[model samples]
Target: MTDTKQEADFLIHPENTFLYIWQLFMVALVLFSAISLPLYAVFAKDIPVLLIIIVFLFFCDIFINLRVAVKTKNGFCWETAEILKSYRKGFFIPDMIAALPWWLPVALLFKNEEPGIITRFLFLLPLIKILKIGHYLQVFEKSLTINPTIIRLIKFIVLVGIIAHWLASGWVLIGPVKEGLPADDFSKYIRALYWCITTIATVGYGDISPDLSQNHQIIYTMFSMILGVGIYGYVIGNVASLLANIDVAKANFMRRMEEINSFIKNKKIPLEIAQKILDYYNYLWETQQGGNDSQVMNELPQSLSIEVSMYLNKTIIQKVPFFTKMNEVFIREIIMQLEPLIFLPQDYIVRRGEFGDCMFFLSAGSVDVKGSNGELYATLGEGAFFGEMSLIRGEKRNAYIMAREYCDVYRLTKESFDELRRKYPDFDQQVIETVAERDAMNKKKTEKPAAPVKKQ
Candidate 1:
């Protein structure tokens, strides 16, 4: 198995075991709670207290479940919200179930950080409100994923909510309809909410009014105007941002598709091979786009022309250490024969025992040169050449070369070397000189002895 696969398997095994234990514990808790609820109702004879305890326990269970869900990597906010809703319904169980708004619990859980005890308790109300809002947002996000059209619908809802709150608060202070209002009835709350919505939307019909006795018209008027402007701006800003993100995503997708098409056309790849290239291209594109692509072989296509051109340019630049002193035409010819090779991290570029048929010019990244002494002799980076000894002498590689990271190399094979040598007679002399200098350096390093120890 690949290293990634092994690591994934290791991570998953523990998670699965933990999930199983968690489920078992939850089942036990639920069964115990179910048994205790009725027993307490019958024996204790204090139904309200028993009911309160049961309700509190149910909420506690929900809190625990939500905590677990959020901690898990695959946690879905919607799922956690649903659990909270279910717990609330169960706790209230009978007539006119008095469940708090969903946002209350969510906001509490997602607070900025730990605060002073009193501050934390004070913030709890807002936190719960925000959590309920987040739950709706989570649902909206999921809806967008399934049907993007829902994004517009969600935006409209937010605008309506903002407008409603603004108008209701404003109308209660300024409008005539608010005068001589009954304080106790449900109609009072409905009218207040309605007026707030209208004022916030900036569609004041002048029907509602505040009592002249209150003399707080200016405060309500200022509050509504400010809130109206903020809400309107927020809605517009969010809508604009969402649209921009969608446009960017579409543009990127088109760009990748165009790249794939260009690759297929330029390479003249067969349909089957082209399909694989397209798949791989998509994989790399998604990786670049930040998504999963394991189910599809998202390997990027090797554009022969582009790869060859890049190899020529990089090889010529890298070979400057050797070729700057040589004829320009000869350097160009040598570069033309070189091919680009990609190696993943830790891949052996040149195994010690393998018969080396090519010399590699590093275009990018680093490689470790493992010597016979079982230690890394040196690390070679871009512009460095390796496996050249075998190319000059027609022998096996003297050292192993392992990639330190994903690398791109320009390789000149033995056949290409021989052809170049036959074409350019002077090349042999340069190769011999380069090899001799490297050998002399190696010999000196080996010959150098440890210094005599001073008597202590």
Candidate 2:
């Protein structure tokens, strides 16, 4: 059983380059254990060098597992006792099973007689080590946090293809040793692979058929037919599922884009307007995958949607002192009422003397605050807000705000603010105080010094 704390806690150390290097080494060792070890055993001779290489890899496997367990245990913030318990339950049993083959070779060194059935069976023990690949996959899933989709695809291929390759290669290596098995072109691996592919595809070309007389050969042929069908079904189904999931949304988005292009060409819309439309659509597609955020939010329960809204706008709302003073629940309610607005370069968001009924929070890009005569007063970027004073006081806008570039803002209507004020008396008091301070500042800016007139 996993500790409750360990299950909830995941330490993501992306800055640790050494950890990444270690993970890569683990992947290499897993591949060697799962794929290479079996291949080596197939053609292994009594060479001392081959023995040394096999033994070295076997020790490396043990060492890597130990190091990984220590790192993982530390990452989980495990105490000494907990680490010991986890090591016993998680690592010890599986590591022992994987380590079983390492001793088999050492035991065989004392044998003076010719190699027998026992020797061949000893070579087969490494197949048990392939179980470690599952553990490695779990580690990789937890440790690595970059390019997740590509990494997942690579894992899937390694998990499936390596196992299949091992089984096929093992069959080819073992088939010739059996009695009464005809050894022709069928013994060649290239020929065997061709046969396997044909069989798996259910397209037996009659070029390679098993001898029916020998029981072992018949059994082997039956196994191949069954295994081939299974492999084909599994591969085809997964590939189809992956394609269905990955491309359906993308294909629809492309079709919609093409339609927009055709419409623009036919209508001959102004270049500026067309480009703005394209930019808006591109931003929507990139950020939300061409889906409506409001529509998606409507599908969820109000409580859940509000929570999600709170999470999404947390940073922006925190930057605005107005929202920060309100309790989190009221803040969430305010966020839920906010709607997204986009502006292109040079677009006037609000002109001085225009009636103001909405405030804006800049989520992205920048805007220039200009005086009545179009003199630049100030510039505001992401996390800045404007127009709230006019909206609160039911007055005209104080300044002209123009988009310096393409901008994304969250608009909060006066209706929503009024509704909030009516619900929360304390929040209403705060808003009134804020409006007073803002009005005083504006008055100060507009007031002229009487002393200058006396000096003239």
Candidate 3:
């Protein structure tokens, strides 16, 4: 079962299995129609089975569109009237033109009749569906969890195929090749496709030269040349652009590392230190995509930032007994104040005998809580936190906190905790009482050494 929140995000009800299947079917069907419909018009006279299927699906989509949930600022609006209104105001006309009976009813009435201008014009009506397909594809993209780049790449490939097919169809209409037009439709299409491939790619092998004597052929060849240049440039540019954007985070991280490497080499840094620096950055890129979470959050609106922070910290925050009981608003406040920290392997997060001024929550990797001489006390994995005792007692850290691996942790400073604790009497009182108890114990231990010696 799909979660309501996720469904809300997509503005659809997953509970309607029929509707879900229909939507998936339509997205694919529409794509097929977008490519096949135009090509079929150029080559074949009789209606293809695909045209019939598309026409049927198009009408069915209109019916389905009216009942599907509509998303608004509040949430998914399930009201039929609203959905209808939305459909009407949006792609209703394009969809209507695309789905109409067009030449189908007439073709059925006269099976052997040649398609006239009327039939051709009607056949072209469904081409408008191509416009609405993009709109539907946007929704489709949102529904799928896959990377948008993959979808963009798919779209690009489909576009190139469509453009190539269209060019081939146009070539067939002109019969521009020196060998003249083939008698058979299949042969005509294949030869046209071959010519288009060579010409569009600017690889016009001598076998398929255009007839320059014929004015139309000459004009067509010149147009194709100009068109080829645009397409050739576009294909290269688009491919480069797509590759650049495919993994922007990784690219940026790699570029930064290059800069760091150049600097290190220029400065003649020690190999060991340079290697450690490289490892730290590589680990950072691996774990956090080389981004500072707080800085990224800062760019977001306050409400959205808080929501993201809450989501990130929810698991760790819930693990804390005190925090679990905190009010939602206070929890969000605490979450916002936390700064993400990452410690390299064997890095001291907490030095023994160092005064602790902050608390730590291990969000990823493990840390070793050890004694002064590297005697490991325990290992803390993801969601385990430390420094609450320091927060309560206002004392030095008793144990060394070292990251066993590259650890991602979130730190909440004492100042922020102090301010927050004061707002809640229970929290403030608990800290005050715990500190007082520690102070009293320390005083007793100091004074009791002579008494212990006398007893011995």
Candidate 4:
């Protein structure tokens, strides 16, 4: 049952599924209108009615197509689908009709890009729909995802195809080769396709000729020249656009990396770990050069190496209050192994009755101390420390420390404290003295009764 639920969830990603259906429907409607309009024009006796239907269908098809294109541009496919679905029940038919052409949809069935015949033939509705929608959505998503190189590549391809087609047709109309061919022959189709290729490539060979009049030849020659120039200008424009996008994305990425690196450096994340993260980021960036978010995400490591490093040596140690008075070298050594930990607001950093194994030094943040008496104890801030008494007495934590805000603290584990004590027993004495002084201060405060009672 759990597996079935998971499968259902996976199959119906609301974002792409609806949009995919909508796009299919729009395409189907356009083709249907194209055929229906012509049929009505030739066979129907009510010319006025046929003309009106054709005009209405044309306008409807254009509106839907434009809506789809605009929604696609904004990356709002799911929203578009929902909006369209709300209109009428019959709206779904077009999408179904569009999906009937099985080749492209079938090609998307298998996990591999190369589709097999058996897999192609088998119409596993849910799985096939999922795969088809996922793949095309990815391509559409790439229009927003890829940085610059890919955008330039696509523009260049389109510009070339358009100009090539225009120039090829023009050249065939002007040259002598046009004398032998009918207006709508296989030869004309070949000429148009060939022109699409050659003009885009800027390759002008004088092999084909048309036997049209001199005036027509001149007009055709001029058109071909204009197309070639236009293609060149379009390519140049796209190149500039690509460069600008690359610069912006690169600048943004660099800024973010620098900020993260500064954080790690200040918090003293090990150089090795920091380097690993940087390396991984670079690897992901390279792999996702012309890819989308999913591509980049897939290439990223499951978790950062630094996170794993933190979990490895998880021994807890309490801070001795007296350690605050230690020399710079001694303090620095302790701080070196100490990692800064962060806690979210209202989160319990240290719970009452839990075995205390680590000490915390408040670096920059506030924590609420709750005592067993159900009274609110003091809130601690920077330079303040906690969990020391429990660690020294070898007892469970007596109070709960909860973050009043996002809190940052330096933590030292029991193993590290023990190692420090073994190296310098004199330092241990300083800690004991510091604890004694604090205890004496606490006792004095408790003993001293309200002197202001006389005024009242």
Which candidate number would show the highest lDDT if scored against the true structure? Answer: 3
- Separate clash counts for every candidate: 33, 0, 0, 22
**Which of the two candidates, 1 or 3, achieves a greater lDDT against the reference?**
3
User: What does candidate 3's lDDT look like per residue over 1-96, in tens digits?
Assistant: 246754554445634667767767777786777667666777667877777778888887777676577778987776667777888999899889
**What are the lDDT scores of the predictions, listed in order?**
0.57, 0.69, 0.79, 0.55
- C-alpha displacement of 117 in model 4, angstroms? 45
The TM-score obtained by model 1 is: 0.33
As a whole number from 0 to 100, the lDDT of residue 104 in candidate 4 is 40
**Against the hidden reference, what TM-scores do the models get?**
0.33, 0.64, 0.79, 0.33
Candidate 4: list runs displaced more than 4 Å: 1-59, 62-156, 166-184, 195-201, 209-213, 240-456
Candidate 2 stretches greater than 4 Å from native: 1-31, 44-110, 122-156, 175-249, 259-275, 289-312, 318-333, 371-375, 451-456
Write down the lDDT that model 3 would get: 0.79
Shift in Å, residue 381, candidate 2? 1.3
Judging by TM-score against the true structure, name the best candidate: 3
Global fold similarity of model 4 (TM-score) = 0.33
Task: Enumerate residue pairs that collide in model 3.
Answer: none
